[model samples]
Target: MSGPELRTERLVLRRWRDADRVPFAELNADPRVTEHFRSPLSRERSDALVDRIEAGFEEYGFGLWAVEVAGSGEFVGFTGLAVPSFEPPWGRSVEIGWRLAAHAWGHGYATEAATAALDHGFDVAGLPSVVSFTARTNVRSLAVMRRLGMTYDPADDFDHPVLPPGHRLRPHVVYRLTAADWRARRTG
Candidate 1:
């Protein structure tokens, strides 16, 4: 099932398309873009990820949306809500996330696209709260989480379960925003 589309001042967050696969793979392969993860994704792995993302939409009714620049319609990346497959201490929760091409960075695209995703998660999906996390060293994503008014507590930090104990990216920091908090931020 294709997910609902969202629009921002500078972006269009919509479902993935066949045209998006190549660029998505390229983005996934960029070391600069995948630096927060274990390693850049191979083409096959990237395609597989897209398959899973599409399947997530089918099963959950919400999944990562393919993002594009509004006017030019250039595919930049993806941002949306997802259900974390692994168990965390916080229990079941939806996550708002984004990934963009290197050329899309520093333009606030992640922040813009993520805001729309958060709105849908809270306003449309009726999720009580949403969380975002990243490798501790990912200052860029951490900043976006802060901009979205997500609160962070060091106590919430955890070593990523999918990563080996000694891996540099295993250490992760989490940020959370409740529907109440999100609504407050919007109307206050």
Candidate 2:
């Protein structure tokens, strides 16, 4: 099932391409951009990530999209949904996430792209609910979660299994939004 292309006010969400590597690698290399999660990714890792995203597009039909500016056509970053690897408070739930180039920050692009992705997840994918999560100290992502109308689930917070036992980033906070919650937010 091929995913349909989606658009926001000033961006286009499409599948990854070979030519997207350089821009995507650059985005991954930015320390500020990857501060929330792990360290900066090497070019090789970034390329591999693009490949993984491509495969996800084919397998899941809705995965992290290659986000580009409509006018400049710049590959800013990606924003969409994926199944979280860690066992979560929501059980096995789809996750909504985003990562933009530093230059793309403060311009509402993350929110714009994510809003559209959420719409697609519910309307097209027919998902019942979606979850978004981040490090406990990642205030920026937390802010975006709140902006997306997600409610904090402190009881759901847990140590990320992928991280080492003593890792600072192991602890995570999760937020949830159901189809009913989304529809209410839409109408309100």
Candidate 3:
């Protein structure tokens, strides 16, 4: 509870906990869950990722939040804001994203969690905008971005710098949503 906590109708987004590591690791190792990534992660790498996420929360007061179901308290996955390590046209900026287990998909959990995350970015963080990007082939995430009312600009497309050129996951598309736009969407 040292960090920010966000809630939606059916979800609670809060700080990482030790109990979340095993599920988080399983999520990272799932091929269906990591379809957009270069490859599945080893448990060591996954635990390291959890460490980084916790560090981000400690440093930024905001980071990829560990999401849970409201009543069941099941650790679904993560959804929230982070500063992308790689530089793109946007420079250093916060991005909203989500990653849930395959069992948690098709239930609008990602969208529900992401909606709250965007609200936090615009309202709590007072950020002008939040961005999200993924491989062009990632239709599910693209749909979630659209559901969050984020817009796509073809010109903003860029090959993921972390991915080698010509890599299958290199081609990526960018989506953006501004504070003003989020406000409008919330009201209108």
Clashing pairs in 1: none
lDDT of 1 by residue, 2-53 (tens): 4698999999999889999999999999999999998999999999999999
State every prediction's TM-score relative to the real structure.
Answer: 0.97, 0.95, 0.97
- lDDT tens string, model 2, 1-188? 25778998899988887888998899999999988777899999999988777787787789999899998889899999988756775588899999999999998888889999999999999999999989999988888899999999689898888888989999999899999999899999
Give residue 88's lDDT in candidate 2 (0 to 100): 72
By lDDT, is 1 or 3 better?
1
Off by over 4 Å in 1: none
Q: lDDT winner among the candidates?
A: 1
Report every candidate's CA lDDT. Answer: 0.93, 0.89, 0.92
Residue 50 lDDT in candidate 3: 88
lDDT of 2: 0.89
Prediction RMSDs, each to the true structure: 0.9, 1.4, 0.9
